[model samples]
Target: MQATKKATINIALVGNPNSGKSSLFNALTGLNQKVSNFPGVTVDKKTGAASISPTLQANIIDLPGTYSLYPKSADEFVTYDVLVNPSGDEQPDMVLIIADASNLKRNLLFCSQIMDLKIPVIIGLTMMDIARKKGVEIDEAGLERELGVPIVTINPRKNKGVSELKKMIDLVAKEKQSVAPRDFIDSAALAPEVVRDIRQYVQVKSDYAALHVAVNHGELPFLNGGQKLAITNLLQANQFNKTKVQAEEIMQRYGRIKHIMKNTVVEADPLQKQLQTEKLDNILLHRFWGYVILLSIMFVMFQSIFWLASFPMDWIEAGFGALSGWLTNILPANQLTDILVNGVIAGLGGIAVFVPQIMILFAFITVLEDTGYMARISFLTDRLMRQVGLNGKSVMPLISGVACAVPAIMATRNIENRKERLITILITPLMSCSARLPIYTVMIALVIPNKLIFGFFNLQGLVMMGLYLLGFVMALLIAALLKLFISIKEKSYFIMELPVYRAPRWANVGTTMVQKAKIFITDAGKVIMIISIILWFLASFGPKDRMEKVTAHYEQLKTAHPEQSEALDMELQSEKLSNSYAGVLGHAIEPVIRPLGYDWKIGIAVITSFAAREVFVGTMATLYSVGESPEDNDATLREKMRNATWRDGSPVYTLASGVSLMLFYAFAMQCMSTLAIVKRETKSWKLPAIQFAYMTVLAYISAFIAFELLK
Candidate 1:
C-alpha cells in the first residue's frame, strides 16, 4: 500500500503574555520568520516555517498573547478572531499551546478555551525550571492524561526537549485531526438556549465558538451582515448578559484547572531562587529609588547612543564621502550621473550614517523589555500617568514612540479605554523617534559644543538626554490639555503582571538591532532617495530663460578671466540653483518662515520632510550637493551645512537657527507614516487632521520662541 500523503499544515503558538511563547517560536523557527500585518488589521503577524520531520513540515503562526478568549483590546481582537475564525493564511490546522508550567493554573484557562474550538492542540510546557525552583512538581504524564492532549516540556532558551516537542507535533499532524476531544467545560452549560440558537442560526465549529458568536458576532471578520443580524436577534431574544456569561465562564474553567493541578502536581517550600526575584523587585519597584534608577538608566542609554556609535557613524560617513568622490571622478558627467552621485548616493549616505545610533537605541529598549524592567516602569509611573488622564498601559506606547511612532501608535491597542487610547496615540509622535535622530544629531553637532563636564559627563550627551526628556514632558502636558476636552469618559484600570527578573537574551537584542538597521537602510532609504531625485530635478533646473541667462552671465566672466575658471564655475552653479524651480518653491514659503530664522533652502527641506522626519537629512544633502563641484565630494553633510550662507553671504546655520530647526522637528507632525497609523488606529480622519493642525501650530510657536530668544 502507498504511504499516506504528508501535506504541510499550520501550527499556531498561542499563550498568555510573558509565557515564553515568542521565545519558543524564535527557537523553533530561527531566522526563518517574516512579519506582516494580519489581513485588515494594523497588528503585526509573525509567521515562520518549521520542519517537524524529514517528510513533515508546518507553518508556525505566533499569535499575540492574551489571558482569555474574551478580548478587551484591539490586540486581543486579532487573537480571538484568528483562533476562532481564521481566514486565508491564518487558518490553524493544529495548535501548540505554550503554557507556563510555573504559572500552570492561569495558563490552563487559555489552553482549555483553545481546545474547546475543536482544533487539535498540544500543550508545550515552559518555565518548568522556574516551577521546580518554586518547589512545585508536576507529573507530565498525569497532567497529559487529565488534559487529554500530548504534553512536552520545552526550554527554548536552552534548547531543551525541543526535538521531543517536534516529534509530538509530527505525530499529531500525521493523524486525522477532524475529531477533537471532550470539552474541558461543557459549553452547553453556559447559556444552552442562546448557544443552541446561535449554533442553529449559523454553522459553527463548537458550542463555545457559537457563544463567542453570540457575544461578538458583529465584530468578527468572517460573519456577514445577515448572519450577524440573526445572531444579534438570538442574543437579544435570549436576553444574554455578556458580562455575566464571561465571568461565569472564567470561574468554571479555573475550578476545573484547580482540580487538575491538585491531583497531578505537588508543592513544597519555594527555593531561594523565587525569593531572589522578590528581593530584586523590592529595590527596582521602590518608589524613590526606582525613579532615580530609571532616570539614570535613561540618561546612560541616550548618552551611549552618541558615545558608542560615534566611531561607526564617522566611518560610515567617511566611506560614503570617499565613494561619492571616486564615482564623480570616474562616472560620465550628465543628468543621470548627477542624480546617481548626488540624489541616490547622497540620500543613501544620510540614511546609513545614523544606523549605529538607531541600532544602539533599539538594543537598549529590547534589553529593558527582555529583563522584565520595562513592565515595572509602567507600574512606577501609573499614578503620574493617571493625573494626565492616562494609566500605566499608556506608558508602554509612549516609551515605544522613541523607536518609531507607527508601531507606538499601534501599541495603543493595549490601552483599553477609548479616550485614553486616542489621547495616547495623538501625543505619541511627540516623543523623539529614531527617524528624528539624524536631524537631532546633525543640528546638535552644528550648535552644541562637544565637551566633557565634571571629568565624566559629555556635554553633547546631556543635551541629547534633555531633548528626550523634553519629548516625554511635552507628551504628558499635551495629554493633560487634551483630557480637558474630548468628552468620552470611562473608567480605566492598569492591571499588570510583573514577571520574574532574568538576565536579558542577548541574541534577541542583537536580532532586533539587525532588523531595525535593515529596515532603516532599505525602507527609509528608498523614500529618501526618491524624494532626493525629485528635489534634485527641481533644484538643478529652472525657468529656461533665467537658467540660460545665469549660464551666459557666468560664461562671459570665465572668458574674460580664464585663470578664474574654477571659481567662476562654482559661482555659476550656485547662481543657477538660486533661480531653479526648487528655489522658487522654497522662496514661496521663505516669507512665512523667515521670522523663525530659516532661509529659502531650509524652507525647502521643511516642506519636503513632511514625507518623513529623516528625509530632512537627505533633503539637506541633496540641496547642498547641487552647488558643490566634483572636487568637493569629500565634504561631509555637516561641513556643508556649516558653510551655508544667506543671499548676503552671512552664515545661515548659526546657533539660534540650528536649535530652531531641532525644536521644529521635535514638535512637528512631519512623518506621514505616523499620521497614517494614527488614523487607522483611531479609525477616524478627524483626529489625525486635528493632530496635524495642533502640532503644526505648536512647532511654529516653539521654534519661533527658541530662535527669537536665542538670537
Candidate 2:
C-alpha cells in the first residue's frame, strides 16, 4: 500500500545583499540543498526540501539577492522574472523577505516593493542582536500591523526563531492568504493612462505590475510580440516618462518607510558611539594599510594552502599506495589486475591527494566571505579594475577564478555591462585555479628547491605566489587588449553594500570547505578514472608482432644475463610502451612539443588534459606504472618522473621543462568543462572557439619563450 502523500509547498527566499538571507537558507535547508541554474538563465537557483511538519514538506527556492524589483544585473532579473511570472516553475506559494533589523529604513523599502507585488509575504527580520547592540529597538507587532504582513524575528545563524518562521510560512501557504491590504505607493497615480491601457491586453497582478509593464514591456520575456508592440505604442502615445515615474515612486516609498520607522522603530542616539563596522573600516579601508593587509592576507592564504596541506596530502598518498600494493599481492597478476591497480588506483590517488589543498583554499575563501572582508576587497580594487576596462564587480569573479573557473565564470552574471561581463568571462580562466595546483606542486617539487629565504619566507610558496600574480597580470593585460577591439558604449557603475565585519561562522566555513572538496574530488575523479583506464590499455599493449618482438628481445637479454633481469624487465616495459597506441599518438605530437622541452609522454598529458587540467597527474602516474609498488606511492611517481629522460639521455623535467609546462597550463584553455560553460554563458560557439584559439596560441608562445630562455 502507498503511504499518504504530502502536498509540496514552494517558498521563495528573497532579500538584499548581506541581509542574512543565505544564512537563513542554510539553516533551513541544512544539507538537503542543491544548486542549479534557473530555466533559461545562468543565475544560480538554490533549492532544497525542508520538512515544516511531520506531514508537510516545503520546497524552498533561495532567489538571488536583489535590493529592489527594478532589475539591474542578470541575477536580479532572475528574481524579478520568477516573482512576476505566475506560470513559471519557481512561482512561489509564499514569499519570505529577509530584512536586516539594524537597517530597517533601507530594508523596508525592498519589503514595501515586494508587498506591492501582491504575493503572500512574510518578513524574516534578522540581525536583531546587532540592532539591540546599537541601541536600536523595533516594535515587531506595530511594524506588522502597519505593513499588514507577518513579521518573524529570526537569528538563523543560531537556529533561533526558525521553527516559528516555518510555521508562519506553512500557515500562509495553506490558508492561501490574499495580498496585504497596505500599499507602498499609489501606482495608478504614477502612470494612470499607461497602466489602464496595458491592463486591457495582459492579466496584470497589481497596479505596480502594470506600471512595470509600461516601463519594461520590451524586455519582459513572457510578453508576446503583439502585446509588446501594443505596450510600446501606448507608452509612446502617452509620452509616459519611465525615469521620472520610477524616481517619484521610490521617493514616495521611502517617505512611507520613514513614517513606518518613526512609528515602530527607536533609533540609537547619534552621540552613542561609532559602529563596530565603521571602526574596523577606519583601519582596514585606510588607503595605505588596507592594501598592506589585503596583500598580507593573500600571502598567508597561499602559504597556508601549501604548508598546512602537506601532511594530509602525504598521508593520503601513502594510504592509497599501500592499498594498491595489498590488492596487487592478493589478486592474480593479469591485464585486469594491472588495470585495477595501475589505472584506477593510481588515478584515484593522484586527485585524492590534492583534497587537502582544495579544502584549505576553500576554507580561506569562505572565512573571508563570512567575515565580510570579501566585499571590502571589491571596494578597494574597484578603482584599479576600472582602469583596466572593467569595474569593481569584475574583481570577485577574478579572485574566485583562483578556486575554479566554472563558478567564477558563472559569477560574472552579476556584471551589468555586456562588454565588461564578456571581458570578465573571457579572461577569468587565466587565473591559476586549484586544478592547476596539482601540476604546480608536482613540477615545483621536481625542479624548485624547497628552501627558506630570509629565514622566514618559503621559497616554494613565493614561487607559487609569483605564478598566481602572473595569471592576474596576464588576465588584466588581456582584458585591456580585448577592450581595444570590442567597443560597446555603455555606462557602468559599481554600487556595493559593505556588511559589518563579524567573526567567521565556523560551521558555514566548514560546510563550504567540505562541499567544495567533495565536488572537486567527485567531478575530477570521474574524468581521471575513465582516462586513466584508457591510457593504461594504450600504454600496456601494442601491435601483436611488435609486442611479441619486444617481449622476445627482453627474454633473450634476461636469459643471457640472469643477474640483470630487473634491468631487462624495465627495458621490455619501456619498449612495449613506446610501441603502444598511446605511445604512437604521443610520438606524433612529440616533435611539436620538443622545442618546449616536453617528451612524448608530456605530449600525451597535454592532449588528454583537454578534458580537465587535473587529469595530467593521473595520466603521468598511469604512464609511469606508479602502481607497481604500493608503499611510498607518492614518492614513487615523483622519482619515476625525475628519472624520465629524452632520447639524448638528458633529464626531461629540468627547470626549463617544468617552468615551460607551468606557463603552458597557466595560459592554455585545456579544460573542456570551461569551454562548455563559456559556450553556455555566451550562448554561442564562436566565442569559445575564439577563446580556445587565442589561449592555445598564447600558451604555446609563452611556453616556447620560457623554455628557450631557461634552456
Candidate 3:
C-alpha cells in the first residue's frame, strides 16, 4: 500500500510579552521560518514550518505578543483578528498558548479567555526551572483537566519537551481541532441581550466569538458594510456598554483562573524570601549604580566594536583595494571597465569594508536583548526620558534607533500618548543609526588620532560613543522643545514587565549578526551601486565644449612636460572631473555649504547620501577612485582623501572640515526611508515635511558652529 499524504496543520503561538512564545517558535521551526507583515499592516508576522509526526506537517505562525483579546496597539489588533476571525488562508487550526509557569495566574488569565473562544488550544508551559527556583510548582495533569486542554512543560532553549508539545498538537489536530467542552466563563450571563442579539444576526463559531464581534464589530475587517450596520444598530438598541461588558468578562475569567490555580498549583509562602530576580533587581535597578552600570555597559559595547572589528576591517579594506587594482589591469580600458572597476566595485567595496563593524555592533545589541537587560535600560532611562515628555516605552524605540530608525519609529506604535509618539517619531532619526556608522568611522579615523584614553579606553571608540550620546542628548533636547510647542494634556504611564535575566543564547546572537550584516549589504548595497554608476557618469563626462577644453589643456601640458606624463595625466583627469556635470552640481551647492567648511566634492557626497547615509562612504570611494593618480593607484580611500587639496594646494580635509562634515551628517534628516516610515506611521506628509525641515536646519547650524569654533 502507498504511504498516506501528510496532513497540514496551522498552529498559532500566542502569549503575553516575554512569556517564551518566541523561544518555543524557534525551537519548533528552527531554520524553516520567514518573517513578513500581517495583511494590510506593518506589524510583523513570523511564520514557520514544522513536522509533527510521520504523517503530520505543521505551519506555525508566531503571532504578535499581547496581554489580552482586548486590543490597544496595532500589534494586539493583529493577534486578536487572527484568533477570532481566522480566514481560509490563515487557518490557525490550533492555538498554542505559551504560558510562563512562574507567572501562572496572569498567563492563565489570557489562556482562559482564548479557551472561552471555543478554539482548540494546548498550553505549552515554560520557565519551569525559574518557577522551581521560586518554590512554585504545579500538578500538570490536574491543571490540564481543569482547563480542558492538554498541557506540556517545556524549556525550548534546551530543546526540552518539544516532542511532547508536537505530539499534543498532532493529537489536537487529529481530533478535528476539538473546541473546549465548556467555556471558561459563560459569556451570555454577563450581557444576555447583547450576546443574544449578536448571535442572532452575526454568523460566528460560538457565543464567545459572537460577543467579541459584537463588541468590536466596527473594527473587524471581515464584517461587511451591511453586517457592520446591522451590528451597530443592535448595539445601539441594546445600549450595550462595551467597556462595562469587557470588564465583567475579565473579572469572571480571572475568578475562575484563580480557582483553578488554587486547586492545581502549590506556592511557597510569600514570606519565604524574595526570588532571585528580586535579589538581582536590587543591585541592577539601584538608582545611582544603575545609571553608572548602564553607561559602563554602553562604553564597553562601543569599545569592543572597535577592538574586535579592527583586524577584520583592515583585511577587508586591503582586499578591496587590491581587487580594484587587479581588475583595472586585467580589463580593457573603456567606459565599461572604468565603470566596473571605479564605480560599481569601488562602491560595493566601500560598504562591504564595514561589515565587520556592523556585525560586531549588532551582535552586542542582540546579546543585550537576549539576556533581558534591554528592558532594564528602559527602566534606567525612564526618568530622563520623561523630562522630555517621553517615558520608558519611548526609550526602547530611541535606543532601537541605534540599529535603524525605520523599525524604531514603527516601535513607537506602542507609545499611547499622541504627543509623545509624534515627538519620538520626529527625533528618532537623530539617534545615529547604524547606517551612519560608515560615515562616523571614516570621519573619526581621518580627524581623530588612534590613541588610548587612560591606557584603558580606546580614544576612537570613545569618540564613536560620544557621537551616539550626542545624538541621544540632542533627541531629548529637541523632544523637550517640541513638548513645549505641541501642548496636548494627556496622561501617560510606563508599565514594563522586566523578565528575569538569562544567559545569552549564542546561536541566536550569531543568527542576528549574520542577518543584520546581510540586510546591510543587500539593502544598502543596491542603492550605493546605482548612485555610484550615476555619479560616475556625472563625474566622468561633462558638456562637450567644456570637456574638450579640459582635455586639450591637459594634452598641451603633457606635451610640454613629456617626462612628467603620469603626473600630468593625473592632473588632467582631476581637471576633467571638475568640469563634469557632477562637479557643476556640487559647485551649485558649494556656496551654501561653504560656511560649514565643505567644498564642492564633499558637497556632492552630502547631496547623494540623502538617499541613505552609508552611501556617503561609497560616494567617496567612487569619487576618489575615478580621480586617482597613476602613482597613487594602490592607495586606500583614507590615503586619497588625506592627499586631496584645494585649488590653492591647501589640504581639503582638516580637523575643522572633517568635524564639520561629521556634525552635518550627525544631525541631518538625510534618509528618505526614515521619512517614508514617519509618514506611514503618522499617516500624514505634513509631519514628515516638518521633520525634514527642522533636521536639515539643525544639521546646517551645528556644522557651521563646529567649523567656526574648531577653525
Candidate 4:
C-alpha cells in the first residue's frame, strides 16, 4: 500500500473591520471554510483551506480585525494572543497582514505592531482604488523598506493581485525569499532611566531589552511576564513614575510614525479628501435631511423586497408544487407516498419559498454597508438610542433585526458597552423580522381590505409599514423599562468611525446572499422537514372508526349520485377529519381559544406554530390540503377558509380571527432556535425563560384585545 503525502501551512489574515478583510477571506476560501468555536471560547473561529497550487495548500485562519494587538474586548484579545504566541498547534508559517491603503496611517500601526512577531510577513494592501481616489499615494518600496514585508496591492473584490499574493506566500513560506527586519521603534532608548528604575524594584534578565520587546510586539502586562512583575513592584514602590513612563512610550511611537510619513509618503492634496467627504456628508449626515434620506432609503428597501421578489417567490412555490405532484404520481399509494408528498417536500418547500425575500434583504443590507451608509445610521440614531439606554452603535443591530434576528444578534458584538449591549440584545427580537413578514402578509391579505389611500399609495403597504413602526416603538419602551431595573453604569459612550463613502461591492453582496441562503436551506430546512413529517402522520391516519366512516360515506355518495360523488367524497373526508385523533387534539384546546374566534383546526396550527412562527403557514397549507383535497390556489384556500363554520354556524376564518392571529404571531416567542441562541449567547437560561414568559403573556393580551375589538 502506498501512503499519500500531506502538506500543511498556517496563515492568519489580520486587518481593520471594514478593510475588505472578510471579502478577501471569502474569495480565497470560496466554499471550503467552516465557522466553529475556538476550544472553549464562544468567539467565532473561522478556518478555511486554500490550495494555491496543486502542490501547495495553506490552512488559513481569519482572525478578528483589530487596530492593535493590545487586548481589549474578548474578540480583540483573541487576536492579540493568537498572533503573539502562535500556539504550537497554530504556529503559522506565514502572516498575511492586510491593510486598507486608503487608511494607511491607522492601518500601518497594526502592520508595524505585527512585524515585531518575527514571522514571515506579507502585506495585502487592499482598497488601492479608494486610496487613489482620495489622492493618497503610497510608495510600495518605501513601505516595504519601513515595515520589512512583501507588499502586494490587492483589490479583493476584483480578484486583482490575489494570485501574486498567494505565490508570495508560498515563496516566503518555503524560505526562498527573505524579508529584512524593519527599524522598529525602541521604547527603551526613549526612556532609559524609567527602564532602569522599573527593574530596580522588579525582576527581569535585562530591563531595557524586555521593555523594548514588549512595546515593539504590542504586548500588555498579561503577556509580558517580567514586565507584569515589574509593574506590580513599581506600583508597590512609588507608581507615579511608572504611569509617566507608559504615556511617554505611546507619545514616542506616534512621533516616530509622523516623522516617517513626512519623509517617505506623498499626499496629492490633504484638503481635497476632507472637502469631498464633508460635502457629501453635509446632506447625508445633516440633522434634518439626514433623517429624511434615511427614512426614504428604508421605505424603498421594504417596498422593493415585496415588489422585486414577487416573481422569484412565485417561481419557487410553483416549482415545488410541480415537483411534489410528480412525486405523488410516480409513487405507489402507500404511507411512504403520503410522507414524500405531504411531509418532506411540503416542509422543505415552505422554507424554499422565502429564499428570494431573504436574498433581497441581505442584498440591501450589503449595499448599505458597502456605501458606508450604515455607519451614518449609527451617528443619526445615537442621541435617541442613548435615551433608551443604548449607544449609537446599537442602531445597527436594531435595524438589522428587521431582516433576521440571528445576524442582528451577531452585530451586537460591535457594541463596546456591556450594559447597552445587553439592553440591545434584550429588545432586538421586538423588531419585526423577515420571518414574521410572511405570516403578516398572508393574514393581512386575508383580513385587511385592499383599498387605495391618497389616490395611489397602498393601504396594505402602509399597514405593513405601521407594524414595523409599532415594533420599533415597543422596542424602545421595553429597552427603557429594562434599563431602569437592570441597572449597570454605562461606562463607554459611542464613538463611531465613519469611513469615506464608496460604491457598493456587488461581489460582496452576492457572497452574503449565498451564505445566508445556505444557512436557511440547510440548518432551518432540517427542522422544518422533521416537523412536516410528524404533522403529516398525525393528519393522515386517524382512529379506525373515523376512517371507516369517511370511506363508507364516500362509497355511498358515489353509488347514489355518481356525477357529484367526487365532490361529496372530498367534503365527507374533510368532515370526518373533524373527528380524527388530530382533530380531537385540536378540539380539546378549542374552548380555551374559542373566545379569540379560532376553531379546532386553527387551534392546532396556533399550537404547532409556537415552535416556529413561519411554520404556521405550512401547517395550514398541509391541513387544508388534506381536508379539502382541492386544487391549490390562493382563491380556493380563501374560499374554503371563508366557508368553514363551527357548530354555532359562524364562519371560522373571519376578519376578526385573522387579525387576532396576526397580533399573536407578532408578539410570540415562536422560534425555538432563537431562544436557544439567546440562552447560549447570554450564558443563562434565566434570561431566555424570562423572555419567553414575558413575550407569551404580551402576545395573549394583544391577541385577546384585537379579537374583541375587531369582532
Candidate 5:
C-alpha cells in the first residue's frame, strides 16, 4: 500500500468586522499563532498552524476584516490583492469565510464576492445564538445548495462545532476542488470584451478576476508594465467604465441575494419590537445620560487602574528592591557591581513594576470592545466629533489611542475623507497611552497626596482622570483649530454597524491582558536595558583629571574630619555626577527647561524619553540609584523620587513641577514610533515634521503656563 502523503495547505480566514473571525482563529490555532507585518506594509499579518490530521497540517492566515473586495484603505487593499492575484505568496488553497448568522444578508455580500473568485470556499456560520435571539433562522442545507459551498455553524468561543468545522476544512483541503457558484452576478456582461482581452493576457481563474484585472490593472502587483499597458489600452478600447460596472454588479448581486434569502432564510416579523441592543442603547447612547455615563466609565477605568493594581505594583516594587539589595550585598565593590545593581536591575524594575496597571488597562479595554459597548461610544460621540471636524468613525482610533498611538494612527486608514483622517492622526497621540501611565503614576504618587475626596473618591485617582480628560479636551480643541486650515471638497459620513451586546469572554480578555503585558516587557524592556547600561557608563565616569581631583579633594576632607566622612562621600559622588557625560548633557539643556520648574536631572529624563515616553521612569530609576548607598537600595522608586531635592533645598517633585511635567507629556509628541508611523501612513515627512514642531511648541508653552500658575 502507498503511504499517505503529507502536505501543508494554506487557508485564508476572511470576514467582516465583529464576525467572530478572530475568535475562530484563536480556537483553531490557540498558542500557535504568530503576528507580523505584511510584506512592505505595516498592516498586521497573523498566521498560525493547525493540525488537521496526523499527517496533514494547515496554515491559517487571518486576513484583515473588510466589507468587500472594493479597496478603500491599505488594509482592504491587502485582501483585494491576495484574492485577485492567485499566484501571490498569500494565495490560499481554500477560503474559510466567516459569516455572522445574525446578519447574513450583509455578510453574504462579501461571501458571494469570494465565491466569484473561483477559490475552494467554505462558510462558517457564527453568532447562531444572536440569530435565534433576533427570531431569525437559517436553512443551512438550502443555503449551502444556493451558494454551492459547504456550510457549518460554529461557535468558537464555546468550542461548539469547532471539530466539525475542522473536519470540513480537512475534507476540502484534501479534495482540492474549486467551488465557483454561478448564481451571484453575470460577470461576463459586467465587462465583456475587456474581460475577454484580459483573460488572453493573464491566467485568469474566473471572469470576475478578469474584470478586476481590467479595472485595476494599473496598480495590480501581478501585472508587469507591458501587461498593465496592454490591459489599460484594452479597457479603454472596449469602453470599460469601472464605476458603472461596479454599481451594476452590486445591484445585480443584491437582487440575486434577495431571491436567495426568500428561499433559504426566515425571519419572524419585519415590524418586531425593539431589540435588546436597542433597549440598552436607549440608556447608554442617550444624549444627556450618555455623556454622563461615558465620563463615569472613564473615571472608573482610571480609578480601577490605581486602586486595583496598587497591591500588585507594590509587591513588584518590593520584590525588585529586595533583589537589588541582595545582589548589592553579594557583589564586590566595583564598577561592574554598580552597573548590574544601579543600571540593569533598577531600570528593569522601574518599568516592570507597572505591569499590573498596564494589564488592567488592557483587560478593561478588551471587555469594552468585546461587549459591543465600544461601538456605541462612537455613536454617542458622533455629534461632538463632527463639531471638531471629524466623523463618528474617528472615535474608534481616538479611543484606541488611549492604548497606543501607532496602531491608532494605522486605524485612521479606514477613514475615506483625507482632511478628517489627517486631523485624527495629528491629534491621536494626545490621548494618554499606556506608556504615559508609568510617568503619570510615578509623578502623581510623588506629588499628589494619597487622600480621599467626599470620603470615597481617591484624590490621586481623580488627578489621573483629570489628566486623561485634559488630553482628550486638548485633542478636540486642536482638531477644531486645524479644521479651519485644512480644506477639502469631499463629504464625510459614518456608517457603522453596532454588534449585539454579549457577555464578556473572560478567556479572550485574559489573553489580551497577558499579550499586552508581554509586548511591553519584551519591546520596551530592551530599549530600557540598553539605555540604562549606556547611561550608567555616562553617569559613573567623568574626565580623568577631574575625577582624580575630586577623589583627592574628598580624601583630604575625610582626613580632616573623619566624623563627616559619610556625608562628604555623598557630596563627592554628587559632584562627580555633575562632571559626568550624562550630567553635562543634562546641564546643557537645563537652561531651556528651567523656567518650567525642571532641574538638570529632569532635563536628562526629558531628553532621553523622546525615544519612548515610558523610558522616563527607567531613566529616573537608573539616575537615582547611581549615587545611593547600599543601605538605601531597598527604597521604592516613588520613595526615592519623593525624597529628591533641588539645590535650593526645595523638593524636586513639587506639585508645580509634577503638574508641569504631566502637562508637558500630555501635549508633547515624544514617541519616535508614532512619528515614524505617521510618516509611513502619510507617505511624507512634511506632516511628521509639522507635527513635531507644533507639538513641541505646545508642550513647552503648556508646561510653562502650568508651572507659573501652580507655583
Candidate 6:
C-alpha cells in the first residue's frame, strides 16, 4: 500500500517586539507547538502547527522579533540567519509580516526591508481597532500598491480577520510570487547620460543593488553574499569609488517614504493623538516621578504575588501532602509507593506549589507590556541605564530575570548594542531567579526574626525586598566596572515605540500567562521527575549488611532509652543516614564543601538540587523525611529541621549557616536549564563552562565570607 501524503505549509510570523506577534502565534498554534534551539545558535526556535483547511496544515514559526535586517546582537543574528540563510529546516514558504496599524510608518519601514526577499510576503495589520478609534485612516489599497504585499487588518484578540489571513497564506503558498520591485535607487537623480551608462554597466537593477549603494556609503551594512559581490562589482566598474553610496541610499529611501506618507496617509488631528499618549506619559515617564511610579508598580507586583498567591500556594502544598498521605495508606508497603509519594509526588509538587507565583508574575508583565508602559520605563530609565553602561532596553530582561534568568537572557534581543547586550546577559543571573525563592522563603522563615523595620513595614518582607534591590545594585555596579575593560565604540541610543494607552487585553495576557506556565510545568517537570526517581533509588536501597546494621542499631538505641528514646532515635537515624548509600555520597562530597559551612546531608541536597534551584526544598523534604521517617504528629518540614544537629552538638541550621546558604544560592550556578540555555545562546560549551566555573567560584567565596563574618 502507498503511504498517504500529508501537506504541511510553512509560515513565518515576523514583526517588531510588542507588535502582538506572540499573541497571534499563540492564537494560531494553540497547544500544538514545540520550542527548540535553532541549529547552531542559543536563540529559541518556536514552531507550532495549526489546521488552515481540511487538506492543509500550517507549520508556523514565531521568529525572534527584530526592528531591521541589520543584525546587532546574537539573538538578532539568529533571526537574520533563519530568514536569510537558505540552509534551514524552518524556512517559511510565505512570510507573514505583522505591523501595528497605529504605528504604520515605523512598522512599514521594517516590512519594506523584508519585501525585497524573493519569498511571498503578506501583512497582518494588527491593532486596527485602536487605529480606527484614534481616527487614523489607512488606505489598504494604497499600501498594497506602495509595497505590493497583500494586507489583512485583524484584531488578534477578537479573532477577527484571522481566517482571511489563513486564506491569504494558502493562496500565496499555492501561487509563489514575490512582492513587486519597489526597492530601487535614484538612478533618475544622476545625469541622463550618466544614469544610462551606469545602468548598462553596473550589473544591478533591484533594491538589493540599492542596498549595496547605501551600505557602501554607511547607511546600513551590506546584508547578503549577493549584495556584497554586487557592491564589489559596482565599485570595480566605477573605478573602486569610496563615496557614501550607502548613506545616499538610506536618505533616498527615507525621502521617498516621507513623500508617499505625506500624499496618502491620513490622520485625524495628529497633534491630538500624540498629546493623548504624552499627557499620561509626562507624569509616568518623568525623571523623578517615573522612578517612583516604576518602583511602586514593582512593589505591588511582588507584594501581590506573595500576599495574594500565598493562599493558593498553601492550598497546593497542603493538597499535595494530603495526596501523598492518602497514597501511602492505600498502596502496599513497597519501594514503588515510596518513590511515588516521597520522590515523584513530593518533589514535583514542590514546584507545582509555586505556579500561582509564576502566573502572577506573568500576568503583571503581560499587562505592563500590553499597555505600552514598558517602553516608557525604558525611556525613563535610559539615563540611569547609561550611567551603568547599559541600555534602557536592558531593564526588562533584568527584571524578568528575577522570574527566570534563561528567558531574561533570551529577552535581550531588543538591545541593539552587541557589547551592552552581552554584558547584560553575563550579569543577569546575579539577580536571584524565582527558582531560588523556595529556598529563600524557607531559610528566611527559619532564621530572620519577624519585626517591623521602622515600626511600620513587615521586617521579613522588607528584608526580602532588600535582597531584590541588592541584586539590582550589584548588577549595575558589576556592569559599570566591566564596561571599563571591554572596548566598544558603538554609539548607544534608546528609541522605542510608545503605543497608545489602552485597557489591558485580558485575552492576550491570559494566553501568555498560561502558555509560559505550561512550558515551565512540563519542561522543568520532566527533569525534576527523573531526578526524583534516581534520588529515591539511592536513598531506598543500600549494601545489605550496612543497611541491616543501621536498622538494628537504631532499634536498639530506641529500646535502651525509654523517656529519651525518641530523641536518641532521631540521632541514631541521622547517623545511619550518613552511612546509607545517599548518605555516603553526601559524606564523600562534604569535605570539599565543609569550608562553606555545609554538612554531608546539606551537601547531598545541594548536589541533587543542582538540577533546579527550586528542587532544594523538595530534595530536603525527601532526604530528611526518608532518613528520619518522622512520626505523624511531627510531620512538618520546619519542625524536623529544627531538631536537626551536627555531631558537635551545634544546631545544623543556625542564623549564620542559613544566611551563608542563601548567599551561596544567590550566586550559584544551580539551574541545569540555565546551563543548557547558555550553551544554546553562546553556541559553544566554552561559554557555559566559563559561566559555571566563575559562578561557582563566586558562590563559594561569597558563602565563605558570609559564614566567617557571622560565625
lDDT of 1: 0.89
Off by over 4 Å in 2: 1-5, 555-565, 626-635
Q: Quick one: best lDDT, which candidate?
A: 5
Clashing pairs in 1: none
**lDDT for each residue of candidate 6 in 591-703, tens digit (9 for 90 to 100):** 98888778887898798778888778777767766665523312545555667778878888888888889888888889888888767665678767876887789788988
Runs in model 1 deviating more than 4 A are 1-5, 86-91, 176-181, 221-239, 270-274, 330-337, 555-567
Taken over the whole model, the C-alpha lDDT of each candidate is 0.89, 0.88, 0.88, 0.73, 0.90, 0.74
Per-residue accuracy of model 1 over 470-567 as CA lDDT, tens digit each? 88999999999999997997999789878878899898899999999999888888899899999899999999999999999988999999999989
Reference-based lDDT, residue 300, model 6: 76
Q: For model 3, give the 10-residue run with minimal summed lDDT.
A: 627-636
- State how far residue 341 of model 5 sits from its true place (Å): 1.9
Q: Residue-pair clashes per candidate, as listed?
A: 0, 1, 0, 0, 0, 10
Which residue pairs collide, candidate 2?
Answer: 321-630
Task: List candidate 3 segments past 4 Å from native.
Answer: 1-3, 86-91, 330-332, 487-489
CA RMSD per model (angstroms): 2.7, 2.2, 1.9, 4.5, 2.0, 4.6
Residue 674 in model 1: shift from native, Å?
1.6
Instruction: Write the number of the candidate with greater TM-score, choosing between 3 and 4.
Output: 3
Candidate 2 lDDT by residue in tens digits, 1-711: 988787888889999999999889988998899998899777789999898876678899999998899999899999998888747778888889999998888888888888988888999999999999899999999999889999999999889999998888778877867368857788988888988878898886788888988888887888999999988889889998999999999999998888988999999888998888899999888889999999899899888877898899888878877787788778887778789888898888878888998899889988998899999999898888888899999999999999999999999999999999999999999999999999998898899998888997888888888899999999999999999988898999999989888999897788888888889889999999999999988988778988888888889889999999976776677788998888889999998999999999999999999999999999998888732333333345677799888777899999999999999999999999999999999999998999999999999999999999999
Model 2 poorest 10 in a row by lDDT: 626-635
User: lDDT per residue, candidate 4, 1-711, as tens digits?
Assistant: 865554678888888878888878987898899998665456787999998765578889998888765655667866765665523355567778889888888887777656655566788999888777778788888877766678998888788999998888777877734343543566456556555675453343344334433343324323356555655555445433544665765576677677767766777765564646668899998999998998788777766766677788778777777776677667776777667766677666766777787788889988998888888898988888878788787889888988777768766776777888788887888888877876776677677777767876666667777777778888898888988988777587676568778789787799889988887677667666776777777777778887887788778878989999778876776766776777878889988888888888888878777676677766766666566452442223344566677777877777788888877777778877678877777899998898889888887888899899989
- Alpha-carbon deviation at 45 in model 2, angstroms: 1.1
Q: List TM-scores for all candidates, in order.
A: 0.93, 0.96, 0.96, 0.86, 0.96, 0.84
